[model samples]
Target: MKHDRPKISDVARLAGVSTATVSRALSAPERVSEETRAAVQQAVEATGYRLNLAARNLRHRRTGGIVALVPNLANPFFSQILSGIASVLGPAGYNLLIADTRTADAQTLLDYAEPSRADGLIILDGTLPATALQGRVPVVEACEWVPGLPAPRVKIDNRAAAGLAIGHLADLGHRRIGHVAGPRGNVLTEARLSGTAEALAARGLPFPEEHLYPGDFSLDSGREAARIWLDQPAATRPTALFLASDAMACGFIGEVQRHGLRVPGDLSVVGFDDIELVAHISPPLTTIRQPRTEIGRAAAERMLACLKGETREADTVLPVELILRASTGPAPA
Candidate 1:
């Protein structure tokens, strides 16, 4: 009761053609004579032969797969990005492997290009060394990038986007503004922090040396920043604070409330990365909205182009939008 499956050899024999002719007919039918193609079709139907893509790819030395590595997979910020990547790769018959790199070492990143692993990689982390990425497999950096490393990248103009936040606060008549920047040594931290300072100076405003706080783009860091702000006397404390992320903004607002300070009342606040939760919080966060999904889709497409041996510029910068919501208001009277 065991039935054998039909193969390409059987189809070629039935069509009275050589195996090479059969392959050309199936893969590049336009190149074959119409009569040969028609004969191959008839033979294919008669023998019920289905092409084996795995076998063909094996012979071609292709794994038909790619990989995506992110700094933290558990973070909700990366969900839409990964979705965008799959949308493109799925239709092209390529499989995607998501790699969580919070614990990845230098060797782990370097080993991504080894044989039988993946054809290419899309890296979301920006801190990896350039030495770890020199390999035959292609790599594309998305959202964040390490300075001085040469790699194709898709990201927003961080400095200009941060400037927009500062300009908004200034427009609201806030002379005393503080900034909670991302981790030190991070490219984003340098860009946004410099942008904040530059925007302040452009408006004839001065930044107190002690007003800037270092944050790791985490909720806990935001809470700690609020405490530091509170330690200052009310007269010297900044009336407005611009945090690097929505999660931090939410934490700052929550922590300040515990000290009987209300957002936009006792202290006006602004945040970056207008995540969905920011809109539903007690006071909606007024922040810059990054096109996270767009960045991912563009990165995926760019990676595909690289795999085809196409060369591209090192940077692709996207625009950002500032959303004004309830969290920010006119400086307190």
Candidate 2:
């Protein structure tokens, strides 16, 4: 009842050729004689023989698979990104394997790069170290971490995105603006925070050192950040808050609500990453729209190129946009 998979040996026997000839004809057809190639092709169809990809790749020094590293797989924003990555790699005869690096230790990133298991890697976590990644495998950074390694990457201009947030608030007459930056050491967080400061300075607005709060790019951190912001004197309180993530913004909003305050009425808020629920929330978030799918697709394409040695080290940055919604309004008079 079980039909055995047709093998190269079967094809070689039917084609009246050696197994080496069959291998070369299938993998590197250019090396085989035209007559031998035709015979192998005909036998391949007659016997319904599919090349043993695993064996052939082993012989040819290839894994034929790729690994993706993610910081948090549960985040809805990453779902679209994963879809885009799959769309690109699936058709190219590559299987995607995900490594949730957060669950793994910091040093374990190297262990997952075994060339026998995965030909290359795409890392979404930016906090990883450069030395741990060197010469292990071809790697590409997508959206999050980049260690200035000789690898290709694709991301948004974090500083520019942050500037967009600041400008939006300043235009709405928010003179006392505060920022809830991402985790302390994250490059994205630092870039955005720097951009926020730069935008304020350009507009001649004050960038109070005390107004910046540290967060870990989570909802709970956002809520705690609001408490820190509230503890400041009323006069020094930021009339508007620019949070690094939508979840964070939501946390801030929730905390403010528990304190009997309303968004845009008592405290205006802007968030980064226009996540799925932002529009549906009571006060729709004003935020930056990151091209999540594009980030994934671009990273995949770049990784493929790296595997093929078609491209060297490079940085690819996607654009971002500001989405205005109810969460932000003219600063409270």
Give the number of the best model, judged by TM-score. 1
Query: Candidate 2 has which clashing residue pairs, if any?
Result: 126-145
lDDT of each: 0.87, 0.87
Cα lDDT of model 2 by residue, 1-333, tens digit? 999888889999999999999988887687999999999999999999976677766776988888898889877778878888998988766788888877988557778777866888888888877777768888888888765666787999999999999989999999999899998778888888889889999999987788888898899999999898878888778989999999899999999888888889988899998889999998889999999999999999998788768976558989999999999888888
lDDT of 1 by residue, 197-246 (tens): 99999999879977898798889999999999989988988999989888
Off by over 4 Å in 1: 1-53
* Per-prediction TM-score to the true structure, in the order listed: 0.86, 0.85
Q: Report the number of backbone clashes for model 1.
A: 0
Task: State model 2's lDDT.
Answer: 0.87
